[model samples]
Target: MATAAVFLDRDGVINKDKGYVSQIDDFEFIDGSIEAMQLLKAHGYLLVVITNQSGIARGYYTEEEFMTLTEWMDWSLADRGVDLDGIYYCPHHPGKGIGDYKQDCLCRKPNTGMLDSAGKELDIDFANSYLVGDKLSDIQAGQKLQLKANYLVSTGKVLCEKGAEAADGVFTDLLSVAKAIVNG
Candidate 1:
């Protein structure tokens, strides 16, 4: 009787991907994103955020900044009656990262480390879960874990047409993805 979750990518999926948006002013939730999250939450879906934070490794921002932003984002979501179960991010880049972040890490997307961790802590049934992201790496990660569903949204780096080819389904944005998950 394990729980299942909806893994989400932060950038583009949550907010606009305006390039390393570490500032509060730059953070903007996509249209209907909050309502979508609320719907998912109401349906007993555990919301988990899995993101690749190369900005920290690239020296564009610090982990503390990232944490601050997460706090704000979480608070905002809570305001809209959406509560997230957990959030995981990888600061490693393997090539473009600086110092310790330059090396490969298991928590990075395209790998199942974060999902594995969540499975352990949240009792997530990977085969019964879903992942929504705007990149191939996100789809790759979901496939790696053999998740029940993988959704690619066209609101980010990967367009819907392109992501649709690789994902279980393509969505216009997080809101659409949310609706599909709740009502599908």
Candidate 2:
């Protein structure tokens, strides 16, 4: 049977959005994020990370560096008793990407490519899943796939009024969202 999932945005939503966070030293989990994942996991929600890493296209970092940091993040989360089911990222930037990275790809948010890929690969039940992101694009992406709900959290970059209005719900952070999901 397909599994319900909680799709997460990496930067801003999970970790502090320190611009171009490609190094372990720069990765800092937002307060309560780890706990949020643990709570979701305990409730049987598969955790999947969906992010836009345009910095790779901009040459700020390489894919290898990103992978290394991701490994560290996975390990850290595992140590804390949370295991992410999958992670998908878009390294393309239509205008600013360097060389091969400069393409308008389907994997970027608002396009639903990454989410679609996750659905197929992970056997995700889109109608039963939820998405939590800090940006409007993230909510848009989830909306396109008709997920159970899309939430915008305030712990990352400053959220604009429009972004707040676009989400199915808005919360102070991931933990709040998790609580809402688990309790309901």
Candidate 3:
């Protein structure tokens, strides 16, 4: 059977969006973010992270560094009994990328490449799934996939009025979104 997932954006939704967060020392989970994942897990929603890591393409960090940080994050969440189903990132930037990192890849946000990959690899049912992100591009990606709902969380960057209006729902934080999903 296909799984129902709650696709998440990494920087804003899971951790504080410190620009180019490449080191473990700089990574900080937003308040209640871990608990929110736990709640979603308890409710049988597969927690998958889909993010655009343009910092890598821009030479701010290496893909190895990103993977190391991701490993640490997975372990940290495992300690809390919240196992992430998957993590998909786009390390390409059509502009300002160094070397081979500069290309218009399909995995970037505002595009559904990452989501499409997740759906196939994880057998995700898009119509039964949902997305929670901090930017307009995140919502747009989910919308393109025809997910059941797309939510905007305000923990990272501030959304413009137009961006907020585009979301199926808007909330203060990831925990709030989890509550709404679990209860409603």
- lDDT by residue (1-184, candidate 1, tens digit) is 7987899999988899999988899999988778878888888989999999999999999999999999999999998898999998888889999999898889888988888888888999888799999988899899998999999888888474555688999888988988888777
* Each prediction's TM-score versus the true structure: 0.96, 0.98, 0.99
Worst 10 residues of 1 by lDDT: 155-164
How many angstroms is residue 111 displaced in model 3 relative to the true structure, after the best TM-score fit? 0.7
User: Residue-wise lDDT of candidate 2 within 1-184, one digit each (tens)?
Assistant: 9999999999988999989999999999999999999999999999999999999999999999999999999999999999999999999999999999999999988899999999999999999999999989999999999999999999987998888898999999999999999998
How much does each candidate deviate from the true structure in C-alpha RMSD? 1.3, 0.7, 0.6
Which candidate, 1 or 3, would have the higher lDDT against the true structure? 3
Model 2 is weakest, by summed lDDT over 10 consecutive residues, at 155-164
The lDDT of each candidate is 0.89, 0.95, 0.95
Off by over 4 Å in 1: 160-162
Model 3 residue pairs with clashes: none
Which residue pairs overlap in candidate 2's backbone? none
Candidate 1, residue 19: Cα displacement in angstroms equals: 0.7
Flag regions of model 3 displaced more than 4 Å. none
